[model samples]
Target: MPKIYTEKHLLLFLYNELAAEEVVEMNAELAKNPVLFEQYQHLKSGIAALDSLSEEPSQTSIDLVMEYAQKLAAAEVANV
Candidate 1:
């Protein structure tokens, strides 16, 4: 398989979106290509940082979302 040359392709590998055969091909390329190794490191760091992000929604946003959801539910019931 050809070396992955796009962020989308790299993301597929980084996120385990690749099929098993494709992943094996990618690992082979990664072993031979220093540039691909560096790119992988960069992407791995980015994904790790993203994974560590906090999940708690802000109170204001949560309230607004809940309000909108209630309005949608009310509208749906009224249309029934």
Candidate 2:
């Protein structure tokens, strides 16, 4: 199988969720690519720290949040 260290690869690595054979190949690639290795480390840390975020906000929640943000920005501009 062809090995690639793309964003998808990094996300999978962060979760410690690779297949056995893929893990072996990914380790080999990490040995060769220092930059990708660093990226994996960074993403791993982020994944470790990022807990569940609000039980997956609904579309209405997202729309409301965006609207509120825009209103806040507009108010700030009006004040300025």
Candidate 3:
């Protein structure tokens, strides 16, 4: 029986979450299926856009987290 591909499967394939054999199958299907290929291209572009974003949290967000952690540690120390 032929394998049925879905958008979810294409996303999995993009992330390399598919098994080796499934990767091979998906590659073959993408070649023959224009709709699936288009979907994959769209997903790939989205991924690329995400990858181009800043990898680290903003300084303000990091400061808030550090401040909260310090407060927690201080409380723990006071209790001990």
In order, what lDDT does every prediction score?
0.87, 0.81, 0.90
Whose TM-score is greatest here?
Answer: 3
Which whole-number lDDT from 0 to 100 does residue 53 have in model 1?
A: 96
- CA error at residue 38 for candidate 3, angstroms: 0.5
Per-residue accuracy of model 3 over 8-43 as CA lDDT, tens digit each: 998899999989988899999999999989999999
Candidate 1 deviant stretches above 4 angstroms:
none
Candidate 1 per-residue lDDT, tens place, 4-43, comes to 4666777899988999998898888889988988998899
Q: TM-score of predicted model 1?
A: 0.81
Locate the minimum summed-lDDT window of 10 residues in model 1: 1-10
| Deviating ranges (above 4 Å) for candidate 2 | 52-80
Report the lDDT of model 2 for residue 23: 81
For candidate 2, what is the lDDT? 0.81
Clashing pairs in 1: none
Query: Which portions of model 3 miss their true places by more than 4 Å?
Result: none
Best candidate according to lDDT: 3
lDDT, model 3? 0.90
Model 2 Cα lDDT, one tens digit per residue, 21-47: 888888889889999888888887777
